[model samples]
Target: MVVMKKMMIGFLLVLMALLSGCQMSEVYDTSVNLCIIVANRKNQPDFSDSETLNTSLKNVIDSYGKVQIIVPDGAPYIQGTYSIEEPAKRMSSRKAADWRDIQISSMYNILTTTRAQTPEVDLLSAISLAGRWLDDREGEKQLLIVDNGLSTVGLLDFTKNLIRVDANTIVEYLEEKEAIPSLSGIDVTWVGLGDTADSQQSLTPVNRKNLECIWNSICIAGGADSVTFRGDAPSTGNNSESLPEVTPIDIIAEEPMEVPAKQSRTWWLGEEKCQFLPDSAEFVDIDATKSLLQPIVEAVANEDLILGFCGTTARAPGATEQGCQELSLQRALAVEKLMLEMGMDMRRIGVTLGRGYNHPYYINDRNEDGTLNEQIASANRSVIIFSLDSEVAEKLLKE
Candidate 1:
């Protein structure tokens, strides 16, 4: 009897040890707040890939602790719980399966309803909204953006080649518009970029690469932890394949334009009075402006020179400081896009800084009678292009 009792005690001790080891090997579930932004529009072909998108959505919803679906330009948008509740006990297989089914049904309904309601694709607004939604949330945060990465409205207008503009330029624009969101600790995944089949223009390899770089830069600048680009069909599993690597851009040197060997030169591209329409960034004469920029473009193409554009705006009556700054940045970007079209290297161009009512060409715009002078204010609304030699360019770049 004593031997039998000893054996039973030994057996119980071994069983407890094995159970503790099994418990240690088990991974604790860490909650994640996931936000998914879907861009629904006719112009974006990626939206048509419903099967892949739905599968990816289902997989993510099933895996994450909490999920939110947001469509900035559509109805029934921004639906999902902000916080996830932890249960006292682990969910059973049946309960988990039911929960997933309910979530999938809810996601499908919300997405379909939103798509039917709105066809506009406002990617910037949707992303900003997602960032705002994720702010202050606990646990791991992830943002999945399913779109062609095109913004037709708001500060970023892809139709205008805004993506070609430098990242710093876009950051400044966002700051001025108060559209910058706190996205620290967020892992951002951008899927379905440049899949614009129904659009008037088709995307080339170079165009696609530029678009990806722009978004990557934008997300990083906005304090995102990381940015990944997954093409039209992202894999739903852990070993999912990544998008094809973007090739380096080849810069072809063009014939140099005749200009004096100067350290720096500033060219003002504007009308006779340097006048622009009230709160407008559209150039009056694109052809003439390009003609004037030909020399600078040639210089940048042929030499290792850097181009810097400064946009200055005059404060109009009742114009907010932020509004003026945003207008100036847009005007600068307009010129930057022209330069890009003219075959200048995107990396060679510096950030377009917006100086709103700060650096005025016509400082004496105030009339003797203390009335605001429209002519001088108009002069202030000019895009000044500065061409710098190698030394000057390096110095300014360091600064």
Candidate 2:
């Protein structure tokens, strides 16, 4: 009786596989489904990493598994059905190293694919398409998203007002629109959330925190069982210009463009204003700094408000924390002294504070090989003059 019963159970299982048009091996084998999406654009780091995530991304990027290289423009979809190759099994000693070589080649291809760029980033749609990419695959699903978390062409646009908005509110809006991706049961890892490169402006700590909150909330609400965030600063290989340009997000928080009735306005002495020599507070060109601030001094001469000088210093080689701070303070004071020499009232100048490395206006000032580029460093270490708005210039020009 026991033999008969075993036979009957085996027959039923075979029948089930046959009805599903699957072989017995196919019915039970579950392999991995991994999708890596890189949404970086011009001014954001092209996806470069340590590549230490999982055995050289094995079982993730395997031999003969074709990974699509996509820079999201809009309406992202799986190009067509694809077959994921099975992970390698043992090879004969004659061909022993051949199997290893194939996977290594595949890993290189995967990494290189992400370096491509597009004009627009429809990140939300890409996330949705990734879900579809993983659906028919064999095993436990995993999603690795490498981006700066600033999407340009979707509802989560940073160009408008999403950066300053609350995270939960953004998630709720996504929920209402039914725009959230189906990330249930998938493990998601995000890298380089707030890191910017090239022409993209650097984010303040407050902006970085808000970007983290918004992305985390969205991933969780999509029912992802596990979500991970990584701060792996990307290499400085900026290949974004060759492709169509992506719109940059405004890193500076919103301020009144037109002069307000009662507000102290700030002005950035743009990229080429007064860059300095390494570790020196004195402007590289004292005459240039003088030329830049001359108009401002004359306009605010009659104003009753106090002009505040805020300066920041760079982390040059062998520079200590105290040294960085002191250098930044001196930089600010140097600007103030120059203004005074130009007939500015000392009484109008307010307390000068050196922000030091606390706030970097431009970030990722390193070479592709991860060494500090002093030229980039010199450019970021500078000062901003603020007391009255550019409206002061408008008023003076009209008078």
Candidate 3:
């Protein structure tokens, strides 16, 4: 009798363990709101291909699991592919002085919808939809598979356009429609658009086939998800062009001349370390520093004079002038050492100290003290500029 009782108890415990395991698995296998945007039109000659693609998607989705077809029907979590035209538009100003090849056509019609859905429809919607699968601890990330390439204009230009949209148009639309912003509070896991995948065609629309392949794979292999997508540029032709012998311009420094014309002093990191740096508290990573130092090293080899500016900040709430100076010095020395390692002639390169508390160029408070922070740290920060006389500096500054 005692043996029977022990066995019963053990069986109950085993059942409970199985139930708990099932619960844990259910938590990880989340219901994803997949949104796939394809560029196509039903009335066009390409309609046949669209039908085939749709059927393929249906088969794939059915084979995987329950995927709700996201149409206009009030589903918050949408997974539908739509079409857009070729030759993407330039939302911002003209690129070249001539304005010959700049594309100004809006592929997706923005007039039918009340607000600008391109930001949401193209990229933000997918990101937000994917981000909704947060666990109990509030950690849900999504991968953005943008079918279209990002606008290839400069970063500042993109930021400026975003600001303009926010201030003038998008904000008003949000307020009038009483719609909570779709993309206000989501983190991007990986932003894979159609631009980066192509070797020659870095700015092309992502094809429907490849996008479907990636999405199907993701659904099949479920887990803690990270965003990863490759940009696919448009394929122009199969034939490879022969390379032409050309002179490479030295952008990092200026060559010494017997008679100096008006010189302009500007600073740039070598191709690799062009990313933004938030604060000096973070130690400069060796690889990041090295990336910025490559151009300087190359320019110095051509016997060009280079200058590096070192400056500190007292902008952070607890920061002091002394501390800022020390940090600035470290940054300067970091760049200096990198140039030395790259076989640069240290004699041709000069390092100057410009540590200060006042920033005249910026209008923001880094400390979040709720004060109008109008300090320009860019002027005081370490930079490499060409050597020039006071008259030339003033002229360049005005220009």
Candidate 4:
């Protein structure tokens, strides 16, 4: 009878141990709101970080979470949503691994079906859709964006000369259209900011910074809790032309130039002739500078023509945008002072500003070996005369 009593106590302890284990597992169970956006287009490379990405996948697989996938801004947007549920009963490690396999497979299948959903990628619209989806979720929210932040469509279209526009201006426009997302309380991470694939022009350092700043502004304006730019940038990008065509942004530096003449509507008075002292806006030969401006003055000499002088300088080491703008302003001012002395009205001279390296009328002055071509760069350092009557002039002047 004593032996039988001891056996009952042992059985009770075993059952208690099992119950304790179950409680611990339940305590650790967590759910996450994970939304991933993949921009599968011609201009963006694939998100090719295997190790880190697999780890992210594993975390979602091991927990009770909501997964959302989006391919944005085509003729129509594409999205897939799935929920991860915990098993009702505890299973062995092998079974758990098998469960993760099933989950990943299902997710992969959904991604496979999304490839043909959109013709091009529109990141803003995707973010808007993701924000709404996350609003429905009931857990810690996270969004992972996998693409070059350069959007080819919608209000933030780079093709529409949006690259030259400032971030604050972009935010204002987005707000006006109500296109910006409401991402309140959500953490946003972008994997690729300026990483571009072919049929797309590569971003310069300034262009990349501007690209990043614009997107960051948009996300912050949309009320995101945190905006993080993180990346495992892939060395190799997809160069397939079969993907939807993304229009290349026309960099002013790469545009063709026409010679300035007495009757010419546009004037590109280059540095070789204007002869400004090196690193100084002071004219090397005052008469030479006057001669260069004479043609522009002759062309826009009439009452109806308002001339806008934009000064450009060659790219230098460690040049800031503000500094470049200041230099451009100084150079244009030097010419403006001369014009004012020559009896041109200040009101008729619409813009006398420095463009620095931002507005290069001449093509890339950098050699294949990454050295500056002095001759090419000299051509780039010049003044562009814009007659306010022309469409291009009207556009820049916002008249």
Which order, best to worst by TM-score? 4, 2, 1, 3
Indicate the TM-score of model 3: 0.27
User: Which should have the higher lDDT, number 2 or number 4?
Assistant: 4
For all candidates in order, the CA lDDT equals 0.64, 0.67, 0.35, 0.72
Score every model by TM-score.
Answer: 0.47, 0.51, 0.27, 0.56
Q: Candidate 2 clashing pairs?
A: 31-139
Q: Write the per-residue lDDT of candidate 4 for residues 1-399, one digit (tens) a residue.
A: 999999999999998766543421223245777888874566666665534445555566666788888876465354767877878876655566677778777776675445524565577888988899888878678887777877777767887878778999999999999888989989888887787777677777778888888988999999999998876766465645656666667654434467554332566677767777877889999987777677656555564666788888776556676786687678878887887777676777776667677652436777887778887888778877777666546544542
Query: Residues 3-41, candidate 1, lDDT per residue (tens digit)?
Result: 999999999998776554331112435556778786344
Worst 10 residues of 3 by lDDT: 40-49
* Residue pairs with clashing backbones, model 4: 328-354, 329-354
Model 1 bad stretches (over 4 Å): 1-29, 46-64, 74-77, 82-109, 116-119, 232-399
Tens digits of lDDT, candidate 3, 1-399? 999999999999987765543310112342332333232211101111233323333322322222222211112235333221221432222232112122111112321121211221223333234434322112222233333322212221121223222322433443465422233222222223322321323221223333333333333233333334443333332221222111111112224457755344445332124322555523347676666667656655654455544443435556676776676555556566666777877675554553434333322445355442434434334433444333323333331
Q: Indicate the residue-level lDDT of 323 in model 1.
A: 80
Ranking by lDDT: 4, 2, 1, 3
Whole-structure CA lDDT of model 1 = 0.64
Q: Compute the lDDT for candidate 3.
A: 0.35
Cα shift from native, residue 251, model 3 (Å): 38
Root-mean-square deviation (CA) per prediction: 24.3, 23.6, 27.6, 19.9
Candidate 2 C-alpha lDDT tens digits along 1-399: 999999999999987755554211222235556676764356677555534333325544443343433345543434333344643453343343455456556555655554434466677888877876666555677777777777887787788858889999999999999999888888888877788877778888889999988988888898887888876657757765565566778777645468646455676664378766766775678788888889888866856667777776666656676777788778778888988999998898766777666563545566887677877776667677776344532332231
